[model samples]
Target: YLASEPGGRHVRLRKKGKTASLTFKVGRGAHREEREVKLSPKQFAALWPGTAGRRLRKLRYEIPWRNLMIEIDVYRGKHSGLVVAEVEFPDLATCREFKPPRWFGREVTSQNRYSNVRLANE
Candidate 1:
């Protein structure tokens, strides 16, 4: 997903193995949806086993404002000090519309900066 802030939001079509998803802001912890995936860890891995990287897990906090939702990730482990807030948009054109808070760090979408798959092996 692309990263962005207030003026609007950055957007990207995420590319994954056989599964790609589009997720965006809703309410608060507010957005809602439904889905059914049938796969145990074993089965899941067998289908699309992921990569290895530094493992990091955190509590995600979503704060809503106007038409945007700021997502904060409080990470644990090697990347512990790192906290990132992201706003997903519909396209790059729209991303230019917003202003991100100063606290936000570099945009890391393509880097897989927060992928747990990479985390597990780091």
Candidate 2:
């Protein structure tokens, strides 16, 4: 990421339709902590230009599957045609027991290449 620190901690500004937010993340991998704060349109416009090379756009859809929710992201712009589905778990045991549908392809859980920060890199 263009403004990311040495570690996994980073701050990101996201614009979803007419809404905007600022997200702060800490730690790395699957156990990271995150917090988001909504931003005004004016605030977003002021901060957006500074994030020129570090941006990506995607339309996310949440699908309810049994007891879990699957998040599907349809990437745009530089990563056009890229689609990913993710399921969040509260603990490691749950993640281990989850079974993906046949439609799912190879898993890239720990791969650095598929990470959002890398995808957004210019």
List RMSD in Å for every model shown: 10.7, 1.9
For candidate 2, write residues 1-122 as lDDT tens digits.
32677588888888878999988988666667878899999999888897888888899999999788999999999899989888887777878888998887788768768878778874
- Candidate 1 lDDT tens digits, 10-85: 2222223455433342222112232324445455454332322322456678888557788887777776877767
Tell me the TM-score of each prediction against the true structure: 0.46, 0.85
Candidate 1 local Cα displacement, residue 98, angstroms: 1.3
TM-score of 2: 0.85
Best by lDDT: 2
C-alpha lDDT of all candidate models, in order: 0.49, 0.83
Regions more than 4 Å wrong, model 2: none
Best TM-score among the predictions, by candidate number = 2
